[model samples]
Target: MNQLPQEYYQRLEEIQAIDFVLVELTLYLDTHPDDYQAIQQFNQYAQYSQQLKQAFETKFGPLQQYGNSFSDAKWSWGTTPWPWQI
Candidate 1:
């Protein structure tokens, strides 16, 4: 298999980091639903996550399946590397 670019890992790491933050915020909000600050932060992170995923998918491929990602005319399932591949 061909080696992937450094940017791929970088973007993936960023997404993971944002996702972690989102998860933590979600848990906090579950118990503290009145915290408007936390809610705002969660929304910001969620938007950023979507943007990052879209950019990553445009260059690499879909990060998920089951209608979560966009696809071209040809099938991309077998073309892109899986998360565990790298």
Candidate 2:
């Protein structure tokens, strides 16, 4: 398989890190239901994740089979090289 671009891996890593933080914040919020700070941080991370996903999709195509990530210009999802194959 060919190597994927560094930016693709970097973006994926960032998204993964954000997801991890969101999960941890969710657990904390569950125990401390009134922790407004944690809630705010969680929301921020969630929005950031969405933005990251959108950017990734726009540049590299859909990460998943379903969603708004698919382009109308052409079916790039199946045609574009997979990350592992790149």
Candidate with top TM-score is 1
CA lDDT scores, all candidates in order: 0.92, 0.83
TM-score of each: 0.94, 0.79
Which segments of model 1 are wrong by more than 4 Å?
A: none
lDDT of 2 at 3: 63
Q: Pull out the clashing pairs in model 1.
A: none
The root-mean-square deviation over C-alpha atoms between each candidate and the true structure, in angstroms, is 0.9, 2.4
Off by over 4 Å in 2: 68-72, 78-86
Query: In candidate 1, what residue range of length 10 has the lowest lDDT sum?
Result: 72-81
Clash pairs of candidate 2? 2-86
Worst 10-residue stretch by lDDT in candidate 2?
77-86
Candidate 2 C-alpha lDDT tens digits along 25-68: 99999999899888889999999998998898888777767665
Model 1 lDDT per residue over 1-86, tens place: 89999998999999999999999999999999999999999999999999999999888888989899888677786687887888
What TM-score does prediction 2 earn?
Answer: 0.79
